[model samples]
Structure formats: structure tokens, C-alpha cells
Target: MAHTTKLNTDLTGKTALVTGGTKGIGKAIADELAAAGARVIISARNAPSAESTHHFIAADLTNAQQASSLARQINDEFGGIDMLINNVGGLTTPGGGYSALTDKHWEDELQLNLIAAIRLDREFIPVMTARRNAVIIHISSIAARQALWNLNLAYAVSKSALNSYSKALATELASKGVRVLTVSPGATKTPPMEKFIADYAAAQNIPEESALAQLLQQTGGIPMGRMAEPEEVASLVHYLVSPAASYLTGSIYAIDGGALPVVS
Candidate 1:
């Protein structure tokens, strides 16, 4: 018998904060949450060139002072958020193995990917703990498990640290009303990914399609034979943070289309 189960994803009274929400996966998440009736607020270093429906705050979260100010502003303006999506991370270092990376490169990667989320969680976890049914999601990458040493060394290391931190935090907050989880997406079709492909193609003097194929081959290829759409990742996140996912916590959810060869 096929039984239909309706998911309670309604966020009519909830507020969400999505960092780096002006573009890519973060933007998609903000849009999806907004469509699901959440009051979404997005933060980035700069405002978007075009206007958007979601509230935008110019904040460089990599800076401790800026992160604190952003948190204070959100608490004052929105009375603390019900959902915190830590999506303000990226691969902002040079490629070509460990030697190509310097101390500054490692520091930058960790600051952007791991420390920023830690600071934000520190600011909002108290507020979330005080309230009932709060959710905190950390947007990670499959690179945490499968690293292309020449390309994403520093970035992958940072995400690996983030994964560990998320699990520990989730365990600590499990008894509290807050739910903390990590969402790891593999090779999603986002603006940054497209640009990465294009740049690779140009550098290798090959077509973009070939560059993409080579990159996929490096990652052992996706069994699904394609990259995930940003919306698809957003949909999974929506489910994880929704009321229907109340029992799910203290784990890493992979949206990688079976790209991971071994079971995690």
C-alpha cells in the first residue's frame, strides 16, 4: 500500500538568517525558505546589484567584530531567528596541493568556513535555546570526505573541521530545544561552480564540457551522471530544518547523488 505523508514545512511564524544569501546555494535557500513562508534575512559583505524581497544586511562575517554586530542587529530587529543557516563559506585559496597554500591561505580558509560559523552559533545558540523548536543548519561540502588534494586542499580541510564541530554542537544541544545539523552537497550547479569549470577549461585549453568531465572523473564520477541543482539542495535543507524533521539531529546529511563510494 502506498501511503501519502504530508510534510509540515510551514514556516509562517518563523524567522531565518541565511548568510551569503545574495548568490548561489545560499540565495536558493533564502528563496525556498521565503516561499515556504519564513521571514528570511540574508547577510553578505556587500549588497546585491539588484533588489530582492528578502532583507539584506551588509556584513563581513569573517571579521569577529562584524559578526558580533550582525548578530546583535538581528537579535534587536527580528527578536532572534528561529532558523540559522550557516552558508557563508567558500574555496578562496590557490590550488596545487599543500605547497601552493601558505599560512595565510590556511588561516583564511578556516576563518571563512569554520570560525565564522562558530562565532555565529555562539551568538545565536543562547537565543535559540531559550525558544522552543529552533534549527541550525551548517552548509558543508562532500569535499570534507573526498578531497581533490591539488585543488581543494585548504577548503576541504576547513569543511572537515566544520563537520566535526557541527556534530559536537548538535550533541550538546540535543537535549535543548535547538536542533543542529550539517548538510553536505556534492558538485552542485551553482554560480561559483560554473565559474570554476570555466576557469579550469580556460587554463587547460579545453572545452568547458571536457573540463567538467575531467573534474567529475577526479571525484570518481557521480552515479547520477549529473550535478545537483541548487534548488534540489535547498529542498533537502528545507526538509531537514522543518517541523517534520524534529527527530533528525547530530548527523551529516549528504546530498551527493551517491558520489561517496563508501557508506559514511
Candidate 2:
């Protein structure tokens, strides 16, 4: 007979909502949570490229009205959720330091990366607080700390703001039975990241491998010698939102493979 070990991460009877959950890290989290026995719902601006088992809702979280509608629908249908994953952020701004960034560029990045999550949190907080224990995961980027000016200036600033906001919110909600935390992942192998590297290689007239190396070098290189898999990030998030992590809150957890030079 084979012996089996059980993990404390079982989420039976819990409901979860993952923003930008159609692809990349968001999709990974949605799948992981569902596998752990949670009823999962995913929201994205557009439909997924492939079929998904989780309940799908179309909502561009950057739009305030759509964010509100998404929350309303979830409440009306599922009553509420135990886990909320704000995973809809990205580096949409162009490279080239502050001079290359316009006011609109800054606004767009902040709106998507920070404000959208804040809006959703406000909408769900009341419901979440009423529950026994609720968790909110903010998906940030390692760029928040070691930003490459010519690559992700506006995006980095927005994520940094999100970090501060997450900590403060966690402090405020701790007594209310809600937990808020930030997860900052370094370079992960995803479709958008692959596209970014391919485009960079084409623009620089270099091979894809070289392009990846240059980008990693700019970030001080991952000591692990490779980028993270989306599933790996999902695993960390799974633990963070699980019963095992009930005591954790108000901190930025890095899944950067030692790419972030600082000790924080």
C-alpha cells in the first residue's frame, strides 16, 4: 500500500475570484485553487484563447463601472468569495526612463496596476470582512524594487505604489478578519513575456537567447539561472491564501529566484 501525505492547503467549500484570470499567472492561480477544492471564478477583458473549466466573467477591471459590475454579479450569484486575486497588471508603457513617459502613460499604468485593484478591493471588502477569514493577493512585479528605467519605468512605479497600498490595507483590515498581501514575481515564462522578448530581439537585431540574457543581466540575473514558471508562482499564491498562511499578511513576497539584489 502507498502512503499519502495531506497538505493543509485544502480549500474545500471556499470560493475564489481571480482578475485577469484567463491567462498567465492569473490562470495558473485559478487552476491551482480549483484543484485544491475551491470554486473558482475568473474575470478578464476578453475571452480566453482556450477553453477553461472555471466560471468566466468578462470585465475590464481598469474600468470602474465594469469592476463594480463584476463585483455585483459575483455577490448576486456566488454570494461572495473567500479569496480575491488582483492579477491584472502588466508593463504596458514604453521603455526609455522618465523622459519617455507622458502623463497619460503614468496614469494608464497606475490605473491598471494600482487603481483597478483598489477599486475591486473596496467593492469586496464588506463581503469579505463578514466572512471568517478572507484573503486578497496583489500580483506585483519585481520591477517595483529593481526597476530598469529603459524597460519598465511607469510599470515599476505603479507596482511600488501598489506595494505600499497593500501593506496599509493589510494593517487596516487585520482586525476585521481580512488579510491583504503582495506577491512580486520576477521574470516568468508567459505568453506576454515571450512576445516581449521576441519583439526586443527583433528590435535589437539579436537572437532570442541573447535578448533574454540581456534582459536578465539588466535585472542582475536570476541566481537560479532561469525564469520562473507560472505554476511556481501559483504554488506560492496557493500557500499564501490557504489555511496554512492564516497568520501571514501585510508583506511583499518575492518569487524572483534571487534576482532582487536587496534583502527585503
Off by over 4 Å in 2: 1-7
Please write out the lDDT profile of model 2 over residues 52-117, one tens digit for every residue. Answer: 999999999889999999999999999999999999988888887899999999999999999999
lDDT over C-alpha atoms for residue 141 of model 2: 91
RMSD of each: 2.7, 3.6
Q: Tell me the spans in candidate 1 whose CA falls farther than 4 Å from its real position.
A: 1-6
Each candidate: what lDDT? 0.94, 0.94
